[model samples]
Target: MRWLDADEERAWRALRRMMIAIQSRTAHDLAAAGLSEPDYEVLSTLSERPGHASTLGEQAAKMGWSRSRLSRHATRMEARGLVRREPDPDDGRGCYLVLTEHGLRTLEDAAPAHLESVRRHVIDRLSSADLSALERIARKLEEPT
Candidate 1:
């Protein structure tokens, strides 16, 4: 087995810890806005799309989630009147997850606080060089093997 050497192991551990810390802090910040991370993700995704709607499959793919998982979460959001599903006009077998007025309002309200939280937890903590290095690392990781 190819084991991580001392330097690699330290870097890996630091990366994991940083990610967990950021995620926890961000989640806590979102909770104050009356939204969870998943709620923010779904609402934001729909809001960014044209007509504020997307097919379940498309959204799931975009979010790197399973269709079933997104579908179940959509049901919960729908129950809360944050989103709604409509029959797809072009595809009889599929439906589009749409952002409702309530959803848009909720997202709009939460966005400012969310942005501040992100800046506080991440952007403000990093220098321009750090951000550039992070972006390079992210792009490298995202490249196909």
Candidate 2:
């Protein structure tokens, strides 16, 4: 396999830096609002769907997290009244994570600042053509082999 040459390596490093900075800034901003990025994602995702509930496995997969990580986070949030755990009716051994009313309200409060951070760090940094290019590259990278 051909390794990346100097220019490609430099570009890869730049992309990595941008990715890290974007995530860091967003997480920091969310932290100020009393939420983590993962918390925002979980809350928003559940609120986006009907029933406001998803199985533990489903939540883990959606967040690209392990089941244990999801469970641990959910436990913390549950204690804070952000969510609740319930038995999954269809699967005897499975469980669901349901977003509580408090979680929904918290997510709504955080959305504006979260969106502004994203726009300022990423969206506003790119031109329309660059945005399209980024979309294409990102989609390609996400494709299954």
Candidate 3:
């Protein structure tokens, strides 16, 4: 197998560093709001849905989290009045996770600052061409083998 050249290796390392740093910083920010990255993702996912609700399995898939992890986080959120869990009407054995009013409000309030942090740390640092290239690369990497 061919190895990356110096430039490619540098770029790959940089990308990895950025990914780790960004996640760390974002997690810290969310923690300040009494939310973890997974917790934030759960609310963010439901907020985008038609009724701020989704099935537990769907939420797990979207968050790339295990069922047990999602369930525990959902349970914590429920205790905090950020989310509600109920039996899926369509399937008695299934569960639905819904964002509560407080969840929506918290996300709405945090979004602007969150976006600004993203911009300051990630988006603003990239040129338009760089962003397009990154998007193209990401699409290729995300494709099913």
Candidate 4:
């Protein structure tokens, strides 16, 4: 097996720790707005789509989630009146995940605080050069092998 060298190990560990710390802190911040990370993800994703809707498959793919997982989460969100499933006009076998007015309002209310939390946790901590390097690294990592 190819083992990471000392420098690579340090970099990987730092990235992992940073990700976990940021996610934990942001999750806590989102909770103050009555949102979990998944909830925020769903709301934000739907909000970006035309008519605030997208097919479950599409959304799942975009989020890099399984269809079943997204479907289950959608059910929980629906129970809270945050989102609803509507029959897809073009696809009889599928449904679109549509954000409710409540969902939009909730997202609108939560976004400012979320942005603030993000800034406080990461954005404000990084220099322009750091952000550029991070962005380049992230894009490179995201490229399909």
Candidate 5:
């Protein structure tokens, strides 16, 4: 296998650093808003659907999470009055994840701060050309190898 040249290695490290920086900055913002990354992920995903409700399987798939992970997180959210699970009438084994009013409120409150952090840490750092380049690079990386 070929190794990166010094310049390539430096760029690789910069990319890695940027990822960590983005995660940490947004995490700090979320923490200040009384949320963890998992909480944010669950809430944000559910918020995309009308009424903030989706089948458990769909939520899990959309978030790239395991059913067991979703189950565990949902259980905790349920206990906190953030969400509720309803049986899917068409399928005895299926259930719908419903975000409660409290959940929506919390997410709404956190979104502005979260968006600001994202903008500060990522979006505002790039020029339009750089942003376009990054999108292209990310899309390339996302393609099936």
Candidate 6:
């Protein structure tokens, strides 16, 4: 395959740098909320549901995570009183994940700060045209090959 031209290479490098920068800043913001990146991710995933609960496989799928990874994280969160695991009544072999009261409260408190961080460090830096370009790029990337 043909390699990128100098300008394309520069653009690619800059995009990579931006991604790393945004991820680091977001992780730091979550850490300040007394949650690690993975913790926040799992909690956030559950929070999006109607009752803050989902099956282990559903959570894994939503986060593009492995079942083992979700299981390990769930175990730690359960020990910390942030979440609880129970057998799915509909399917004895399946497990259901529920966010505990503490998890809900923590996530609610963290949402504002996290949103502001994203706005300031990412969205605010972009113009409307830039945002449109970003959306187009993301859509293209998400499309099936």
Q: Following a full C-alpha superposition, what root-mean-square deviation does model 4 have from the true structure?
A: 1.0
lDDT tens digits, residue span 1-145, model 1: 9999999999999999998999999999999989999999999999999999999999999988899999999999999999999999999999999999999999999999999999999999999999999999988987779
| Cα RMSD for candidates in order | 1.1, 1.6, 2.2, 1.0, 1.7, 1.8
Model 4 ranges with Cα > 4 A deviation:
none
For every model shown, the clashing-pair count is 0, 0, 0, 0, 0, 0
- Evaluate all candidate structures by whole-model CA lDDT and list the values in order: 0.96, 0.91, 0.87, 0.97, 0.92, 0.90
Q: Which pairs, if any, clash in model 3? A: none
Candidate number with the higher lDDT (2 or 6): 2
lDDT of 5: 0.92
Which candidate number would show the highest TM-score if scored against the true structure? 4
Provide the lDDT at 46 for model 6. 96
Local lDDT at 104 for model 2: 89
Question: What is the C-alpha lDDT profile of model 4 across 88-141, one tens digit per residue?
Answer: 999999999999999999999999999999999999999999999999999999
Model 6, 1-145: lDDT tens per residue? 9999999999999989988999999888878888887888888889888789999999999988899999998999999999999899999899999999999898889889888888988899999999999999988977779
Of the two candidates 1 and 2, the one with more favorable TM-score, higher being better, is 1
TM-score, ranked from best to worst: 4, 1, 2, 5, 6, 3
TM-score of each: 0.95, 0.91, 0.85, 0.96, 0.89, 0.88
Off by over 4 Å in 3: 1-11
**Ranking of candidates on lDDT, top first:** 4, 1, 5, 2, 6, 3
Best by lDDT: 4
The alpha-carbon lDDT assigned to residue 5 of candidate 6 equals 100
Give the residue spans of candidate 6 off by over 4 A: none
Q: Select the stronger candidate by lDDT from 2 and 3.
A: 2
Name the lDDT value of residue 15 in candidate 4.
Answer: 91
Expressed as tens digits, the lDDT of each residue in 1-145 for candidate 5 is: 9999999999999999988988988998889998888998999899999888999999998988899999999999899888899999989999999989999999999999999988998899999999999999998977779
Candidate 3: C-alpha RMSD to true structure equals 2.2
Question: Which residue pairs overlap in candidate 4's backbone?
Answer: none
